[model samples]
Target: MNLLEAFKQTKFQLSGHGNRNIKVLKDAFEQMDEQQESDMYGSGKIIEEFQDKLASYLGKESAVFFPSGTMAQQIALRIWCDRKGLKKVAYHPLSHLEIHEEDGLKKIHHIEPVLLADKNSVIELEDIVGMDEDVSCILLELPQREIGGQLPSYETLESISTYCREKGIKLHLDGARLYEITPYYKKTAAEISSLFDSVYVSFYKGIGGIAGAILAGEKDFIEESKSWKRRYGGDLISLYPYIVSADYYFDKRSQNMDEYYEGAKTLARLFNECEGISTLPLEPVSNMFHVHFNHSKEKMEQILIQLYEETGIGLTHYLNKTGEHSCYYEVSVGDRLAAIPIEELRNVFNLLNEEIKK
Candidate 1:
């Protein structure tokens, strides 16, 4: 059966609703009315209101919406670099900007990225303090996504913030999954965002929005980004659909992020106890973690198909292979996983282990 068909038939799933159906998405936009209007090249009422709510939630003086996180971060870095007269921006090696953006910062914006820390570990305050090069900004991803969603200590962040302020380096947050990590840090999004000069948040990831990102900062900074957005061909004529979907999902699912975080740890614990499986980072620091298994990626895919066919549970959509018999897959715990009984989760893990052991 096709993967989408499999997911459609499953009663329980292990990840968030990232791969939701078109019908489900269509329902999210049913509230659009005749009175509803589109933003006119970034000047519409709905987009403005959406930006205001994001700015308020992020505790920034102003905010601008972007079509994608790529546009948001690139524009933010360019603004900082233009003001500072320095082209260098520091970030972790595995950061989305570094690895996923196709070097857009360097090729398009002329911003040089200095990779910080080892790929396996989170960026540290010591690394920031020790860096001697002049940089316009330093970017940090809370709950580092590439490394099993690990976050640095609050004390460490304070130290880095203090150093950046003293050094005149703008601190930018790639808070794509900001809501997902709120439960782990025991802090509000605004409190954490306060530490940075500019913050870029995604509407899609943990917020479950359709697709978009928000860049918030002091009035002048975001205003500069607004011009940059136009320059980058990102000023969409109408963004009301994306804006409304973001608003609805944040209201509906964002409140339960804490439950998702706790449930992630719970599920990781159960997975670790199973045979031929290990949860990267052992204890989950956010609503996601990496599960390593002694099998090929193809073998794991077969296992997922078998389990879904027989038990009506879709364990995971994809797995990353590391070695000949070593593979890993990210397990995202969300409302879907939380809705399932813990004993069923346990039974599924036990069955998975039994297959891998055989």
Candidate 2:
């Protein structure tokens, strides 16, 4: 079973978007504008406002909204490859393009992936220096997920951008969790985005939008992307629900993202003080971090379930297998995390460790 979303009852889930109640959507509609024009093929006041807002926020010439990040990125990269007349794109080995997309970028678009640096490591400026192929674009995930939300230093990012610009290789950011790291890096969305040729931010992940992504880039690039959207069946007749929800959350949750980052740092510190457990990066660079344990998956699962049943503190929904005798789980602090006392959470981790040892 997929452990990511499997839980009987969780007082405070460690990761994922808000499992919003049905009324949340109802409330958004109640507050929505009645005079707004409904988007037809991405041409309505509602869609245009959302797109323009994202474009300004990201410091890009234009922006387009997509039904999903998968569609947004696929088309964005396709446009890059087409303009450059190259079939190859570059990204980390474990990025969504490699693992989750199932080669949709390759199978459908026929764009090859030049797995950069290493399979399980962040791509560095030096990594691109030694590349033998002139690729179309380099896709980067801000605070690279699947690796504990680690972010490269701003200096390194700037250097990489300079190098990419010199080499004429377009840079794309898969900033699904961009807002989460904004506070950590001390940079606004546009400041960080200025380094990339194209940037994609998700509405649902960090922002708690209903479901969608905003792809931003130059006007011409975005114009080309719109055509791909129509071809890929992403240009829905009406996307007001996604638009309004994203607009609402972008204003609501984004304000507290920095608080979430601080909470993650505090949580990581407390966990590391315990024996037989540690957080990857030792310090969280974003709102998410990996809690590594020296125990079997079965043992951890049992303890997680037992603890949730007895204490009503759902520290984690599932543990990810890292090795034969090691596992890791992500802890993402949300508004619910603010309700529970930090001391109580620490106690749960301590007890979990003690139980696992036995």
| Candidate of highest TM-score | 1
C-alpha TM-scores of all predictions: 0.95, 0.94
Residue 3 deviation, candidate 1, in Å? 7.2
The all-Cα superposition gives candidate 2 an RMSD in Å to the true structure of 2.2
lDDT of 1: 0.85
After best superposition, candidate 2 residue 295: deviation in angstroms?
0.4
How accurate locally, in lDDT, is each candidate? Answer: 0.85, 0.84
Pairs of residues clashing in candidate 1: 39-44
Please write out the lDDT profile of model 1 over residues 141-258, one tens digit for every residue.
Answer: 9889888888998888888999899989999999998888888788999999999999999877777778889999999998889888989898878877788888888778879888
Error of 2 at 56 (Å): 0.7
Clashes of each: 1, 0
